[model samples]
Target chain A: MSDSDFSILGGPPSERNDESSGGNRTARDDRDTDADPTPELPPGDAATALHRARLYSLLALGLERPDGNGGLEMDDTTALVNAAAALDRTVEDAATAVDDHLTDTAERKKRWASLFGVEEGHTVSPYELTYLPGPLLTTVRQLADIRGFYHAFGIDVGEKMPYRGDHVCYQLEFLAHLCLRDARLRRAGDDEGVTIVVDARRTFLEAHLGRWFWRFAGEISAHDDGFFAAVADLLAALVEDEIAILDLDPEWVPDTSEVTEWNEGIFGAAGRSCGGCGADATGLEDLEGSPGNPRNPGSQTAQDGLDDR
Target chain B: MPQVHNWQLNREVEFPYEESRPERQWAAMFDLNKCIECQTCTLACKTTWTHEEGQEHMFWNNVETKPYGAHPIGWDKRTLEDMGTMEWDGDTYEGDTIFETEDVDWDDPENHPTEERINEDVAGFMPDIEDDWRYPNLGEDETAGEEMDLDVHFDEDTHPIWFFYLPRICNHCTYAGCAGGCPVQAIYKRPEDGVVLIDREECQAQMVCNETCPYKKAQYNPAETISQKCVGCYPKTEDGRAPQCFETCLGKIRLHGYINTPEEADDSDPMAEPTNPLDFLVHQKEVALPLYPQFGLEPNVYYIPPTTAPVDYLEQLFGPGVEDAFETYRAIGDGEEPALEGLLNLMGSTEWSITAFEVDDGEAVGYYEGDEVGRVPITEPQTERDRVDEVDGEEVYRLDIT
Candidate 1:
C-alpha cells in the first residue's frame, strides 16, 4: 500500500510508530505530543470509517438514477465492488449479485422505477415516512425536520430535482458528506471541525437513518432478490457497523405488544378481548365512549374471565 | 344557484351559489409553439410548493407531450371516453359538461363512492402506491403515428408525426368541477380571483373530486388523507405577482393578466376594451383558445395550439375556433398583422400581474405595480459578427471598432 493509503487505514505515522516501537517515544511522537490531547484514532478505526464512507458514497451513487446515459458507469460499479470487498469477504457475493442482476442502463432504470418509483405496485418506498408508524399527515413534520437539518448545513435540494428530503439515497449521501468532511478536518488538524462533523454524523444516524433503516432493508430484501436486495444486505451491515463504531446503543426495540396493537387496529380487533385479568383495566363499554380512557385495552384475560362469570 | 354563461357550451349553467365575482379574474395563456418542454415551470412550482411529504408525486405544473403524454397516465382519454364524443357545428361545441355527463348525487355524502370505487370508476385503475398515482411523465416525448423511414424525405403536402409540450396547472375554472363534486364542500373557488382550493381540515379523502375533475388535476395525498391540487398560487397572485409556473417560464411563452368576464364587460365585444395583455390575446386577437372548453368549466387557462399538429385533432381538443386561432397565430408569426403585434409581444411580459399595457414603437410595455418591468420587442434585436478565417494555418481576424 502507498503511504497515504497506509496512513488512512492504520492511523497517522506517529501513532503507528509508537505502536511499532513498543510504546517508546519515537522521533515523530515528539512532534505529536501537543496533538495527543485530541486523541488520534487507531489505524484500524480510521480505515474502518473511511471504508464505511466509501461504501455509503458508492451505495448512494448506485441507487441514484444514472446521469443522462441511464445506467451507472462501469468504473462506479467496479469501485463499489472494491469498496464492498474491503468491508467484508461476504460482500463479494453482493458485488457479484449487482453485476449479474443489473446489466444494462435501461434494465437498471426500469428496475429502479419498479422498486422505488411511484409505480402501480412499487416494491419499496425510499422515504422514511413510509416505514414510520403515524398518521400520513404527520409525515410532513418529519420532512420539515429533515429539511431543517439539510438547511443547517447549507445544503438545499435543487429546485429542478423533485425529491423528498428524507430519500434513502439523499440520507446516505449526507452521511458520506459528513464522513468525508470529518476525514478532511482530521487531516488538516482542525479539531473543532472534526468534532462537529463527527457529532453531527452520530446524531443524524441515531435520530434519522438508524431509526427505520433496518426495517427498510428487511422489506427491500423480502420484496426484491436482485441488486437492490444485495444493496439492502450491505446497507444493514454498514448501519450495524456504524452503530458499533459510534458507541451507540441498539436503536430499534421490537415491541410485540405495539405491533400487535397496530395490527389489531388495522385488521380489526376481532377474536381478541381488551385488557388482562386486572380490575383496573378499562372495560370494553368504558372504552367505547370514555374519551379520557386509553384507546387500546391491553391483553384479554380479564374480559375472558368476565365472560366466564 | 347562479346562472353563468359558458360560451363553450353556448348556454347558461347553474353554479353552486351566486357570489359576486372577483374584481379581476386571473387568467393566463401559453404558446405551445415556443414551448420546448424544459420543465423549468414544473421545478419552480415544485420547489415553491408541494415539497412536503405525501406530495412527492405532485406536479402542479407539468409539461407533458401531447397525443401520448399525461401525468396521471391517460387522464384526458379516460375522461373523454367516459363523456363520449362531442359534436361541433362550426364554432359551436355541443357536449356534456362534467356535471351533465354523469349523475353524482352530491347531497347524499354516504352513498357517494368510496375511495376504492372512485378509483375504479373514475380513474379505471390503481397505482402501485395506494391512493397515489404515478408516472406523471408516462409516454412523455413519445410521438403518435407511423415511424418515418431513415431514407424518407419530407413531403410538403403530407403531415409528419409530431408532439407538442402541454404545460398544465389548475385551470381555476369559473365553475370548478372539483368544487362541485366535493361531497363535504371541502373544495371551493375563491370569490376574489376565482382560484380553486381544497380545505384540508374539512377534506374527508372521499376522492370524488379526484374522480370528477375532467383534467384529473385533483390529486389524492394518501398520507394526508385528502385531495389537493393547484391552488393557482393565490397567495402570490393576491400580492400582485404571478404563479410560480407563470413567473419562471424559460421559453417566455406564458402571459398572465386579468380578463373581463362577459358579465363585467360593458361592451358587447369584450375585446373592444382590452385593459390587459391577456384580454388582448384571448379576446381581441383570439389567438389563444381554452383547452376542452366543451367541458363547460369555463377554464381560465388558454393555449396557442401548435401549428404543425393536424388541424382536425387540434379542433377536437380546442374547439372549431382552433383553425381561426391558428390562422391568427400564423399571421402574427409572419409579421403581417400589426393589430395582433401587441398581444404576441406580451408573451412572458412580466413576473407580476400586468394591470395595464401599451404598445409603443415595436415594444409591448407592461406596467406592474405602477412600474414598467418588461418591454418585449415585437422583433428581437440581433447582432451580426464577422467570422474569423484561417489562411495557410494562420488565423486572420477582423476587428470592428463600431
Candidate 2:
C-alpha cells in the first residue's frame, strides 16, 4: 500500500505496520467496517480516480446540514488532508487551513445552519437552481437535465435523502458515484465501462457542477471566514484540479446570482393550490349519511376489525 | 395486410405488425362526471416526466374542454377531417382508420414503415411545433352548445348547453400507430406490459411517427433529435404503483389497472377471488368507453362518457356507447350498483395500481397483486351540526353546518 493511501484512510500509525504483521481488525474496522483484508489498490490512473472520487464524497458530506452534534468527523478531516496532499499542494494547504480552523461540532453546526439552512433564509443557497439564470419555471429544465443524467445511470435520490434532485450535495454525490464507477470499471479491465462512466463524469462536470461550484464557494467565503470558508476553498481547488485533469473548458455561470424564486401569484390563481384536499369529490368524506353512501353503516363496523382483516 | 381485431371498432384493422398481444396490457379509466377541468394531472405529469427544453410543447397528460379544446390546436378535428366521414352501424365502425386512410398495403414489404414510405402513405397531418403546441389551453373552460342564460333550467333528460373536461394521455395502444409509422422501426410495445417506447439509440429521427400518431402524442424533441411520447410510467407500473397522473388526480377521476379482451375478461366475483377492475368496468358493466375508438388503435384508456353532454356529440367522441354508458352510470347514483359505486369511490384513493377490487359488506376494497391497498365506503356517513351551540355559557352560532 502507498503511504498516501495509508494517510488518506487515517488510522493509528500502527495500522500500517499491522498490514505487514497480518491484519488488525480493530483499526481497520474503525476506518471502514467493510474493508477488505489486505485489499490491492488499483494502479496509477485508477488509483487517482478512486482517491478523487472519495474526496468528492467527503466534500458533499461536509456541505450537508449537520445534525445537532454532527459535524465533519475526525477521520474524514484527516482523510481530506492526506488525500489533498497526494493530489494538489494548494488543495493540501486548503485542507490544512480547514484543520487549523476546525471548531466543535455544535459551532460548525450553527455555521452550517446560518449559511445554508432555511432558518436564516439560506444566506448561501446550496441549491443549483438558486445560481442559474432566468425565471424558475423556465430554468427548472436545468434541474430536470441534472436528474436526467442521474436517471440515465439508473441512480435515484433515495427516500432518506429527501433533497431536491438539483441540490448541490446530490450533484456532487452523483459526480463522485460516476468517478467511483469509472475506477471500478478500470480495475476490472472493462475498457468500455470505463469509457462510458468517464464520459458521463466529464459531461456532468461540464454541464452542472463545473458551471456553478465556484459561485457557491464565493458565496461561502463572502458570508463566513472560519471552518466553512476553508472547506469552500478546498472545494474550489479540488474542482479546479478535476477540470484540468479532465482537460475541460466548462462554461461558467454568471458571476451575479440571478436567483429565481417561484412566486405562486405570478403564474396566476390556478397555481395557488395543488395537492389539495387529499380527498376527492368536494370533500365527500365529510358528508355523513347520504343515500348512495350505504357504506356508512359498514364503515362503522369495519373500523373495529381493520387490523384483524 | 396484417389484419388485427380491434374490438373498439368491432372490425379487423390493418396494422404494420402481426397480431401479438402482451401478456398483460396496462389500462386506465376516467370518470368524466367528477372532472372539474383542474389541470393538476397536467402539471403532475409535467413535473415528473417532460420538464426539459424540447418538451415545452409536450403535455404527456393534458385536460381539454370537450368539443372546442385540444392541446395541439384542432388535433382531433384535423384527424377526423382527414379520415372523412365515418359512421357506426350498431357497434361496428364503417370508416377508414388512420392506418388505412391512405390505402397503403401493409402486407407489401415495399409499403412497410421500414421502407421509408410513411411520408406518402401514413394518415394524419404533422402538427406545426410552433403554432399547434403554443395554445394548450386555447379553448379551456369554453362551453359548447347553447349560450348560458341566467335562468336556464332544462329538464332532467336534456340540456341545451354543456362542456366536460377530457383528460388525455397516450393510450399505449395495442397496435400503436406511432410504432406503425416509424420508418426506422424504433418504436415498440413491451411484451410484458404493452408500454410503448421509442428506442433513443435506434431512432433515426425520420419523424414519420409524429405525422401518423393520430393523437399527436409522438412528439419530436428537436433538442434530442428524437421522437418522444409517454412510456406509460412503466418503471412505476412494474412495481405495481399507478402512474403519476393517475395518482395525483385531485378529482379522483382516474382508475389504473389492466384489461383483457371480452372473451378473456375475468368475471370472477372480486369478493371471491382477484378480478381485474378494468375488465369489470369495461367488459362486464360497459359503463366506460374508449376515446376515438374508431382511430383503430384500440386505445387502452377508457372513459365514462359525460352524463350531461348531448348524446349525438358524445356518440361522435365515445362511439355508440354514450346512452348506454350514461344509463349504467345513473344506476350507481340510484344505489342499484353498489359494487360499481364503491369502485368509483376507490379510484384515486391510493397510489397503488388496483389489479383486483371487491365490494365487501358495503365497502369497496381495492387490491394490488392480491394485497389490499384501498378500501372506501360505498355510502359516506353524514352529520348535521346544530345552528346554535353553548360554549363557555355563551350561545355560539354555527355559520357552516353539515
Candidate 3:
C-alpha cells in the first residue's frame, strides 16, 4: 500500500512496518491503526482517518437526494471498493455488491426517487427521527441538538440543500467531516485537537447518527434488495465497523415506523409546517456551509470543528 | 466560616468563600403584577443556552405560578423546610442561613472540598434526576388559600384565593452558593460582572453545586457528566444588551441592569444627571425586594412583590420588605412616585441594557453607556371622546371611546 493508504484493521507492528501499499492484504494483515501505533506506523493513523473520511463522504453523497445528475459515480464506486477492501471483508463484500448493482443512470435515478425521494412518500426514510419514538415536541429537541453540533463546529447547511440536520446523508457527511478533521489534526501532530474531534465524533455517533442508522439500513434493505439496498448494506457495514472500532453502544430507535403529523399540534397547523426536509419553525436554519467549513475545507491547524472555542 | 455583609438581611451572613465582589453585579427586576407566565422567557433561554440532550429538563428562566407552582416541584418549599424556621428580626435574619444550617465550619481546612470528596455538609437536598426534574411546571396555574367561588367578588388586592406568576433565573448572588460549595472549585463568579459559571473543564462531576445552591439553579448534565447553570447571559450583558429571557419577556415585566448596594447607591435622580436605574428602583424607591432574602446568599435578582398575594406569604418569600415594596409599588400608580413610575415605564422598551435612565419633559428616557437607547411616555397618551358624534347627519354613539 502507498504510504498514504493506512490499514484500518488492527494489525501487528511487524505487518504495519512492512512498507507495502498493496490493497490485497488479508483480514489478519489489516487491523486497527486507530490505536497508538509503533514508531513505524506514524503516518498510518492520519492516512487511516483520511481513508475512513473518504468512505463516509462517498456513502453520504450516494444517499443524498439526486441533484439531477446520476448519483454514485463509477469513480466513487471504485474508490469505495478500494477503501472498503482496506477496512474489512464484510465492508468490501457490501461495496462489491453496490458496484455489481450499479444500473443505468436513468434507472438508478428512478429507483432513488421511488425509494428515498417523494415519489413513493419516502418508502425508505433517510431521516434519523423517523426511526425514533415519541411526540415531535419531545423528539424535536434532538433536531435542535443536531443543529447545535453543527453550530458548535461552525458548520451550517448550504442554502441550496435544505435537508434536515438529522438526514442520513448529513449525519454521514458530519462523520466524514469529523474524520477529515481527525486526519488533519493527526498530520499536524496536535494530540489535543485530535482528542476533541474524535470525542465529538464518538459522542455524536452514540447520541445521534449511530443510534438510528441500522434502522435506516433495515428499512432500505426490507424495501428493495437492489442498488439502494446494497448502498444501505455498505452504510450498515461501515457504521458497524466504526461502532466496533470506537467501542460505542448507541441507543437504538423503536422498531415500528410511523410518520408523525406535520404540525404535531405544536403550531396548531397555523404557522409554517414541517415539509419533512428539516425546515420547520422549530427546526434548523440554513447553516450556509454546513457539515464542514467551506472556507477552510482541508486546512486543519489543530482547531478542527472547534470554531466556537 | 467567612462572614460577608448581606445587605438584604441587613446583617453579616456566614459563607464558605471570602468576601470578594465583582466590579459590577448583574441584576434584574421582575414586576410580578405584570407577568402573564407565557413562557416566552423560558423558551428563549432554552433555545439560547440549554437545548442539548442532557438539558432537556432544564429551564434557566421559568415562570412558576405561586403559591403552588414550582419547577422541579417544591424547590423552594423543600429548601425552606431544610433551613427550618428562618425569622426576620426587623431587617436582620434571626435564623440559620443555607450555609449555616448544617453548622459545618467552612473555615476548617478539613471541611475544604477537593476533587476526591464531596462536601456533604452543604445544607440542601440533592434532587433526584427523574423525580425532581420531570415536571418543569408542576401545579401550573394552581391557586392557594380558599377555593374560588363564582358569587365571591374580589378586587385587585382583595382576593381570598390567589396565585401569581414567579419567573426565576440564576440569582448570580454576591455570595454565590454554587461557587462556594463546588468541590473542585469549578463554579466561579465572573470578576467583571458577577455572573456565576461552572467551568466545564474544571468540573469533576461531584454534583455538589446541584445540591448546595438553595435556589436549585445549578443543574447536572447527564450527557456531558458536568454541572451547568445560568451564565447570566454575560455575552449579551458584556455588550450592554439585555439577556434573551429579559428581552423576550412579553409582559414588559423585566428590567435589566447592574445593581449597587444601599451604601454605594446612585443618587443622581436622572433629572439633572444620568443615574443608574437599577439602583433607583431597588434602593431609592425600595419597590423591588430580593426573593428569599433569608437564604443568605444575597441574591442579585429582585422582584416587586405581587400586590394580589397575601402579605404573610409575600413576607415569607421576600422577607419583611413585602409590605413596604407593595406600598411603594401602589404609590407609583397613585402618581406619588413620578420618577419611579417613569423608570418602571422605561423597562422592556428596548433590548439594550439600561445602564442609566432619566425622566425628562414627560418622557422616561433610558441610556446605555451615556447613549440614549429607549424613550417612552411616563403616562400613556389618553383622549376623551364625546358620547354622541354626528356622522353624515346621523347621531352615532361612541361606545368604545376612551
The interface RMSD values of the models, given in order, are 30.7, 22.5, 24.1
Ranking 1 against 2 by DockQ, winner: 2
Best by lDDT, which number?
Answer: 2
The docking quality of candidate 2, as DockQ, is 0.04
Q: Candidate 2 residues B65-138, lDDT tens each? A: 76656666667766776787788899999988988888977777677655435534766788776445655665
- Winner by TM-score: 2
lDDT of 3 by residue, B40-113 (tens): 99888886787655676678888877765556656776677678768878888899988888897767767766
Over 4 Å off, model 3:
A1-309, B114-118, B383-402
State the weakest 10-residue window (summed lDDT) of model 2 chain B: B111-120
Indicate whether candidate 1 or candidate 3 has the larger lDDT: 3
CAPRI tier for the interface of model 2: incorrect
Writing each residue's lDDT as its tens digit, candidate 3 over A55-166 gives: 8999987886655643788888999999888888999999999899987677878888989888778788888777787545456678888988888787977776788888
Q: Evaluate every candidate with DockQ and list the scores.
A: 0.01, 0.04, 0.03
Per-residue lDDT over A1-309 for candidate 2, one digit per residue giving the tens place of the 0 to 100 score? 111111111122333356764442232244555433323432337777887888888888788776643357777889888878888898899888878887877788888889988887789988888787755656777887888999989999978778899888898789889878877888898776777777778788898889999999999999999989998999999889888878888999888965432223232333223212211222333323211134433222222222232
Each model's lDDT: 0.64, 0.77, 0.76
Model 2: which residue pairs collide? Answer: A288-B381, A288-B382, A289-B381, A289-B382, A293-B379, A294-B379, A295-B379
Candidate with maximal DockQ: 2
TM-score for chain A as predicted in candidate 2: 0.68
